[model samples]
Target: MKNTILIGACLLFAQQLVKAQSSSYKPVEGKIMTEWAAQVTPENVHREYPRPQMTRENWVNLNGLWNYAIRSKGQAVPTSYDGEILVPFAVESALSGVGKTVGKDNELWYNTTFSTPKKSRNDKVILHFGASDWETEVFVNGQSVGKHKGGYDPFDFDITDHLKSGKSQSLQVRVWDPSDEGPQPRGKQVNNPHGIWYTPVTGIWQTVWLETVPEVYISGLRNASDIKSKRILVTPEVAGIVDGQQVKVSAWKDGNMIAEQTVNPAEMAKLTIKDAELWAPGNPVLYDLKVELLDGKKVVDAVGSYAALREISMAADENGIQRMMLNGEFLFQYGPLDQGWFPDGLYTAPSHEALVFDIQKTQDMGFNMIRKHVKVEPATWYHACDKMGMLVWQDMPSGDMGNGWEMKVGVLGNQSDRDRTPESEAIFREEWKEVMDDFYNFPSIVVWVPFNEAWGQFKTKEITEWTMTHDPSRLVNSASGGNFEMEGTKITGDIIDLHNYPDAKMPDPEIFGKDNILVLGEYGGLGLPVDGHVWQQKDNWGYQSFKNQDELYARYAGLIEHLGKLVEAGLSAAIYTQTTDVEVETNGLMTYDRKVIKFDVSKMKSLHSPLYNK
Candidate 1:
């Protein structure tokens, strides 16, 4: 496939006035690359469509370079500028072009200018942000438009009111990320880097841009798929009409329309298919959807999206061991441990291709599943999974500081007083809910994990119950590892998620099968070697590391083959050590730089294929 995205060469000059491209830049302090490190100016940072689940052709890409200034907290906008920082990549990331830092006591500011596409009298312009870390307040033409708190979910403000008859418009944004110094969900970031904790991403870690729409528009659409019933449900967020609004929905397979439906504003509406094509790693079938929110004679707003009919559930095998079943058949899900970090971007990847490239490479190595360990991905990542046929076991990005010995009782790291603090609990719960709400629409996500290895884990019963109630559509894994019994024979879910390191031993599956499903949450931290392709030069760590690619691949094949044998011996799914190397960890099948795929793909697939059948 011909790649290497090409835009107008004129954009190169236009981008220089905005900011430098960080993609071409490099820094010495870290391995993660930032968009600006390569000098990505406003002409291009993340020009790809931010929302892959729902897309529109008229929307514009606002990524590239922007004037950045680092000022004291609550400082007024300075007429003077510090320099250019790439949009989307945080200031801490090398890809930001300007390799600088945004700390706890400072505010990161951005200013830019763009045109309104010379509106045709009735069109309304909307400003979009894929995501920004911590807290952000936005203004356009020097007028405050809106403010958002969460870092993961996409947010936007209608900018039609801020635009004018002029050929161009001015935009401004302010951001403050507290990192690990505050109560917010900062994930695995710390001021100090050692062991697992690395760097923190602050301010505008996602794409930002503007789009023009009609006076009335379909602002959002939630597409939900039922694997058992072969139906897709869509709910639209509309703005044009109030009472008795009409919505037109269409479903397409390949290029042909298969079904159609009409419904009123808000709530569960269906678009059914006769013989639904189930989405699998080998045959990923997606159905196109065109939903329009209308008022009588005119179409107010419209959006295009796609979904696949797929199911993941826990079912008892002939031997009575509960395992993950896909499309009514057992498929022992095998995948890498994904830390979701980047050398240039830290929390963000240098480019959208860098994001999809990770998943694609993992799949190429013959794995169908990924344990998105302790991090959430941009929407485009999930969309890539949908298109590329990868299974996802999504983990809530972990945070809160407490050591191993303290986090016992299996609560999964909630032993400290912070876990007892009601305010902390509320904040964690709210942020978790925001994440669930953000990605709930993606069909590729098969499981929702609330806690891992008990890091900052507390209030297990309440949190697990809330997870189940909030998202009954997918499986819930409580405390992937804990000192105390978390499943407790009471919690309900598709699989009993267990965690162990480099050991093939199973955790007495007989006890877990009574009330809930059974599966190995983690195991097999096997490491391999390749010259000139590592995240760090020394003090590398993995559950086990090897001398060369041949030896590593051979040992890994044996390990996975042993896992396949365990499928009949009562194993459902097992998450391998990792997708790529992170910081000092070298167990990944691929190096952290992502320039190499260290495994033998065909051999790995051959060993894993039999796990589903047995």
Candidate 2:
């Protein structure tokens, strides 16, 4: 009886300690924040399932207040931590509770404890990280699990053997990110915040979780559809499959099974849907997918997935100029250049709803496309785009901006690719391929922008051709508003894109449109910084600053009116300067805080309607 009382007292003390730590957690102040920041707490932060494409039932979110410490690089793990930081938010971000920078000289460490999920003997426990900046190493119960590089790709490690004999397990993570000090693909993050470059993001900036799955299970699903053939192609990646193990794939629409097929693991299961509906902007149609792994008719594992029947291609118009096609139709694409950043979270959205808000507002303003500018977003952002029918031109997060650039169009022979070191080249190749492969299944991604304005541009022909060959289903914009390399008599890639500012402009159709699609990659950065919504009180600027709402709308309408003429002259698409104000750059349709829309939504929609008619 005395031992039992002692155990109860210890449990209560532990509970009280946790409560005290959680109560001490609060977001850092002294910055412009969004409404969603108020809703964030240690218990309810980013609790949504990280992966929506391939999902299972049993999982645990590891996003909450974790013990964190910043120590010098290469130093041994410290025995004590400084304080608690909110997981999934970068250490420099306001949402992290501890808003401090861990530069190249220091390394960030995280420690947490979680209860193991209920699983059978045949189940394997897997630790998943949605994303971590630069280099990351994981330790489970003091045993080294694995290490992963690349800040934008999801990675996992099997920790079943590293588990302890109790329900509770200890997790420790070590992270090092050389924001501007190294040659990794960090997008627009600089050591010093100035001009276009914003703040640095380090350590974990995405969700980390755990899952329980069968020893031999479906590891991943590569889902793609051929709209012309009316067939959905599914390649199930099985981890450990013995003899007589096969994969069963089914396609459903409106709760009815449209097609089903069974094939050996790693073999493509083609399910043909009769009278297939093509997916496009404003009419997004999604078909559900259910995949099951069977061992001689005994189901070993199952997962839920989805796909869409769509195609993005290039075709010639009556004017002998190439145009972008969606599902074989020439619908002009127009949207904003979305720099996916937040004042509070830096690299992450405060919540999933906050991530969708920008897309939804853009849709309400009558834009059907978005150029994800030089930054790859979380998978949930792309999934939201897929469901909401938003066309995406995904950009590789830019880095290694140490290249010399000459953007003169007339002097064609002056352009050359950046000669990077062997180490730098290899890093770019590996991360770019991983980024492409990680988000390849999302249908919303139509165009792949490999280089933006010569930032880390290298091996132009080789990289462009590889991207084209890697994913033949989508068009590759070799370098958006960057140095263009000539191939024989034609341009290197499928599109010839130009960047203009403060006014509407298009690529010269008479010179290059016959062989490539002409597009205005960026233009119209009309700025109106709201009084209380600006990131900074003074010195905020845009491509063209406006006085009030009326003036901003009038100037934007004029740009739209001129863009319609470019559409008729063979411009296939156009992306405005940005979606929201970022830092001191106040050239957004909405303020940095997202509290005010510079123009009326209905009026902006009406103004943009005419450009689509052509």
Candidate 3:
């Protein structure tokens, strides 16, 4: 009877809290919003599991609404919040319901109350954030639990010790982001919005949740596939291992067990299948993974995961020109420069369906790859790419501008490198390493781009070599479309990439053909803005604008024809300017609202089909 009464009281308190949060809240009115915006509500905001790579069943979503206050940077927690903001959305975003700015001089504060799930003594309550911008500090019951830096990476803290012996507990978070002021990696976000730059994203911009796990559980998994040997190397990182604890990994194809292995906690487990189905674009084959943490014969913990068996390598073609080979087959890669930004949510997508919509549309357009331009997406985006069979080239978000940059397209140019301060270099290195480590498990990532257009290029050889040695499984493009720093007339990385505007152009084959793979990293920023679907009525622009769909299609077709000629001249891959119109830059195939595809879908698909033939 007493337990029932306590539960009732907790339910009543939660209801009153929800009422208080929504009574004074209103979503910010933005000029453009996607169709999914109307479907958004605090009760249903980003309810999907944020992390698809590693998932557990016993988890509580702490999304919904939370009390928020913006205060001076060094101020204490406010006695009362200013208003309620939607979780997983930035405060400056229209979807967050609190379109306010929190600069370096100010801090964004969030407060909420959650009930602790009933758990055994050996269970640990893990608080997870899919991502938060810049610096974040967490407190539980007024006790500081932990702090994390880096805006693009997911982090967690074990708050089991801070939870009092009660049905409810208080949670607080403080965040600070300097945006373009600091030398951190913030891509295209400035204090002021303009062309190619958008509004700043501050505070919690991804899902926040709580999960329970056993004291001794699986921390992480790294799987690498060797297509030649038909074997998968699995390195499982386990925490709190004791004697008699074993890690078991089972791989399944079409719900049938293909291979299984058991190994000790720290040892690497190799699962060999007799005939592994290779993963490739247009025919994505993934094997289901079941991992178990066993104490003797009893299963203490189990997780659902997945993997793909594929390999990416660079080799000289029949003409002695370098090309990219996927599963030992030379396939021409072509796709768009996908800046993962939303019209309403900035860094965060409105919903999981909306997130998957872009990838699906790209696939429907018959593209094979995507160069994720200067932003890391949620794990679910990568997971969707894995399942849908789209290749990826991940870029580290560029920052610390005003470096001495050189743009040389035809000649082998050596530009003066940026002399970043020690602190700036450390910040870049640490965050780059974290980004790589966090997204290393995804099979769709074929290349890592550390610098773009020399935006933050420094210590070129050192950074490129570090990235190569760090992950030898994938190729590296040292500086995509940046000045080619030569070491005795040889480019440093695997691909010699170039950039051109509104036309398909590649590096001079005679100059770069023998040494490195030629690629047009970015081109064709053809724009067509639709009425009622633009971020602003005036001042919207693209590399080249068209008045009608017919004109856009004709020009786009001509670019593809030119691109095909480059393919014959040893060009390997190319990335179009962008996937969607972001902010005032109307260069995307789709409008900012995502309500219209500017070109005919069937014709676009047909035009892109010939690029893959070579």
Candidate 4:
């Protein structure tokens, strides 16, 4: 009888192994995957808390496999799903388990179920989406909850009222993205991807989760710091607050409490940190923050947060040229142009470790900053930048292209600003503001880029001025490598930028550096594709393709040798072509799959050490 039972169990285990090898729910074939992609499974896809800036304890991660269907636009929710798809991975990506396209003509629908979290009578359940592309509408228990229309920022819906009494509830999400057909801020995504533009990502590409909060909770928080004053501002956006309810904020360092403050919901709570440690690239000191909502003295709701007391401004260098200053000192910034894309997961990384790998690699290469070119990353990306002491230059995703301008750098363009329709203009304005507000708290972000090479640049002066005024904490690069708008004799933004390829070049300091900080927004595009580690076998090209690693490193080192001279000539910052190879652009320091680092890390670090002191 015991042998019979053992035989039956052995047969079951063998059958399961076969099923796993030929699993129907596996990543699609044909694309190069990162090391972390092999670690991904349905049970462990982006399990980390989506929001690290603002976190709560009681939450449920709604990631993993979900029933997905692509139907015609405006069609009702489908009765049957086409197949199982991995949540947070776009349908066009291989990691999604269904590499397909929805396009503008169809709507991607997702259906899932979750058990209700244990909550008290006064507890409110909130549904959160870290991010989704284009237009998204949510339905809970077959009832429409709300709709959101931004692709790059986080949004949430209060689902307490829509909850069912039973332990289980239904969640339905419908998403429609017009890609390049509409005038929305989609960075480098085109229906027919070629050259610089790549694949279209539809539906949810970020984490979706649920958290439980009290009846009156802290809905949002805005953290800002003043290095000169040695204080941090904690502004809490509270919901359902009444009389006698107050908000208390406390700061801690190295496991010890440093400061605390209490204020009303509408007022900003200020905590003064004496002898505060300024956050910089070398010493990125982050103070642990705790915010609580109090009813008189009893705490009603609380959240864990953090802050960095750092300041970004502009000042004059010894050469009488404007220089970008960090904490009142000029630091020549140099880093790669980071295009946050993956071969397996498009915009979404396969895991939290995968998302952090690029940043870590860049630091390993001895770069201090990253130019986030034309795309906004998840909040966790910025948090990683903060914790790792990396400076960030955030760019608003470019869209609504085809605006005409002169094809020249270091000079004013023949044309300036696209005459966008009222609808398109309003869409651009609203989304840019939302992106700024959502990421204003991260101390690593030192620059705000409004337009990139005039892709969809409209109302340049108005947008640049507004961004500078809205966030006085960070300098605004009005148009990076884009058309120039002059206010009499000066440029409209804080920096006068130029773009050159292959060889290192800088904005003519004698012409505009004295008034504006001079920068080479993009320069190096040295490519050397490794065998068995490229997106394709042929047509993989860079601005200057090399035959071997020796040639690439020699050219890259020569470019740095000349860039140091420009730094002495009032050049404040420079950005290389990219952090990793994307599609056929083989100009990355590392390969797209992240399996190979083209240049030696220690050698690259030694090559970049002189830029800081130059």
Candidate 5:
């Protein structure tokens, strides 16, 4: 009875501590927020697993309230934190509970305590970060573990040596992001938010977790599918590999093992899938993968993954016009320009369901593809696309400005290239390569867009050729509506793309048909501002604004009708303005809150069906 009373008192004390930590923090006043914002709490923040492509059974979610401090750069860690900030949400976001800005002059520090999971003698504790903005340095148990310098990539550090023998461990992270002031690929983040730019995101903006692995285990897996050859290439990168370590791979379909192969850790394993079903927008068939690391006859490590077999290429149709071929057939791709922003969370979605909701809604609206504009999303976004049968046109976020945009409506125009500093160029190249390699396994990505609308575009020919050579499997759009650096009157890349606002328009087939696939990269930004659902009540605008839903629907239908005509004129694909209203941009299919879908889903789907069928 005495012990039970003591336990109750301790539980009450803990609850009071949590309440006290959250009491001082509150979301900023007078800004639009989503339904998910109210549902966010420290106990249930980002409870889902971080990585979908690579799955492990044992893992710990380190997402919740973490002690945060803002101090000037180069200053030592503060003895005490100002308040509790939610993990995986930027400090500048309302969801974080500390809506404070951490500029370049200051560093954002995060400190959290986690109980160590049960481990075997040979087990290694690995700490993983889904993503953080700009530059980040990590410390475990007061010892510096490692540092990473990419805002949009997942990275990990082996914390086995840093963990002290104890039930509880200390984890600390220090971050510095210059936003627009620095020459990093920040997308639309600006220190001063206005016009196309929004608030800055600092510190961790995605999931943070820990996993235990054996000393000799699979470090990484790169799955490349060759539909033409009917083979799946599995490259297994192993850590702590011994001389006799062997890796076994098996492919499963419908819970039945159809193919298996065993190879050395250093060699690539090719599994030939007989009668394999191809993956496409209409039919996204995925095969289950199981990998086992064996030491002699005993299994040392194992992981579960999945992949799909699909092919993307460009070829001339019967009319001698270039068309985008999916699995050796022409399929017209039509979808929205997904900017991937949220009112409450900025770059980070409020929940995994929220992240998947956008893609599912896009699919329900009958769109076949989504051009992720000027930003790279978490791997879960791509995984959602892969599972839901959505094709993705991934963009490399632009950086290092000073290039003037040349809107070449019909006549040829010349735009000067921005001569970037050596450091800036190296930063762009390294991050771009890392982004590609990290996201290469996802089957939904079909196109790689290096530059968008000449924002920091430089050495177009060299960059295009390098991207093409780096990944020959995918088509490269050198620039989307960007300045075309011509080599004797021909565009450098695979697709000739154009941007026209508030209506349907395409590049002339007579000019680009023989050499490149013509596409309307951006168009149709029809906006309708629903009261109580906008980022701001006043000054909310789109490319074109409408007073009512009927007007918006009528204009959208007309655009689709005109787009069909362009498709007949050799336009292979088209991307509309956006998926959701962001900031002051009210030209989205849905409102910023995601509560009101501006269009009728069934009618939109029906209208889009004829375009693919034709």
Candidate 6:
């Protein structure tokens, strides 16, 4: 049996080191530097736009450098600053300019100075953290104002009271991440980085900024598309507002208004377009939209955002095989295994454009789908996939496989694969539900994969059924690989799936449901690109790496063509190894930095065109 307790500690280290910057970003081996290096400077650390859903000309970019130091587990802030670190990257990340680690016995601390916008006396200021891993405690101007948990979701704190009012202010963050130490939604991270597991991010891994809102402001917004009705439902999260307040929604395309509607906050606000344009990978037409709160007649508060009209489902092919359907047609969903990591940003892409490039390359490769494996992406990622017509199969990030070869994936693999204390089994089941609820709102996501190779899997029948009941619209993959047998066939499975690597073998047609799509959950990790472009200079590898771009292109062309032959065998979709190089994993079609494409774009797209009709 594998010592999972040791594995948990290793997961945390994996996340920090996975930033994988070879030369300038090397770790200090065993030395522990708690303070972030002050070289990059906080003012220039992360200077990009915070929100991509909507744009406003007046907002400020609060990403840059900050003073950081890692304190002992129960210690307070250090008396002196050791160095400067990048604001957004965690202290453990080399890109953070800190290149440090705060192990299980430490707390990462960050502090920055900022001046408020010259606002009137009535305005209120609110600070937001795009995301923070594990547990976080926030303080403003020395006063402990708020704190939060949950690594993958966004949260905020109103620092108005803790502010210096008219003077320059200080904001501070104290964070503690146990990684696999506790029952949180951590994806493939271990203390000892090896094989599939990588380093852990122990602090603010996403953007940290502030936005000023009216005393009575719009707290949040939820947008859902009703494809059958050709309409949408918009709900506002408003504070200090009456229940019957009215709000207006306006749809804009390229700075022009195409549709408009007004409604009481009681029911869904419906808007229609005479000549409607829906979003897909090829066209990716997005209509810019904004919503404003109306107090009787005056515009009180507003927020900017956009959405597309799209639908995903399972449909029957002519031969009665269940197939994955997009917009009501069985288009074999083919694309790369997108791990969503970066040479610099890790979970956070270097820039928004860098994030979009991965999806663009997959589309260029003629794939309309991406299996976002064991990771939840930033909001902009799904927006790009939705616009690019790329469908997404989102997996709930699971943790630590249990003891023994069979328990390794936990109730997966051959021989029932189940081995774990009932205590651990109960924890795994609850965590799965929490992950689904956190990401249930994404429109581009069509499938929920609960267990992949049985990693930490157990009681799948109850879990899969729970997922179906929680979100019935999407398809579910009960167990991705390992231990899939004839007896436990009802263990919460909908689509029949199989895992392949480097090469894809066809699925058996008769065994697949005429209603459940036949899917190759993983395949085609063919690799090879030039030097410098490689994440690692000597040790880089793939399931099969090539010598040149032409050869790589030829192999991918031949690989997909083979899957095309399996289309008649009830096959509806397939996912390749990955979208980019992650840590020691080099199976991505593109390098980690997004600098080069291993295959010719036009040629790859042309080759992929046949899978749709196949």
Each model's total of backbone clashes? 44, 0, 0, 0, 0, 32
> In candidate 4, what are the lDDT values of residues 236-294, reduced to their tens digit?
99999888899999999989999999999978888999879999998999999999999
Per-model lDDT = 0.74, 0.90, 0.88, 0.90, 0.89, 0.69
How does model 3 fare in lDDT? 0.88
The segments of candidate 2 whose C-alpha lies over 4 angstroms from its true place after superposition are 1-21, 409-414
Residue-level lDDT tens digits of model 2 in 441-523 = 99999999999888889998899999999999899999888588886547888988888787777767777888998888888
Q: Which stretches of candidate 1 lie over 4 Å from their true place?
A: 1-42, 117-123, 403-420, 483-488, 492-494, 528-531
Off by over 4 Å in 3: 1-25, 409-414
| Candidate 5 lDDT by residue in tens digits, 70-112 | 9999977668898888888999988888889999899999998
Backbone clash tally (model 6): 32
Candidate with better TM-score, 1 vs 3: 3
- Cα lDDT tens digits, model 1, 263-283, are 887766787798888888789
Query: Across residues 233-321, which tens digit of lDDT does each residue of candidate 6 receive?
Result: 56656767776678788877788887778876644567675467665556665666788889878888787877677666777777877
Whole-structure CA lDDT of model 4: 0.90
Model 5 / residue 13 / CA error / Å: 5.7
RMSD of each: 5.0, 2.3, 2.4, 3.1, 1.7, 10.2
Those runs of model 4 whose alpha carbons end farther than 4 Å from true positions after fitting are: 1-24, 408-414
What's the residue-level lDDT of 64 in candidate 6?
Answer: 67
Cand. 3 TM to true fold: 0.96
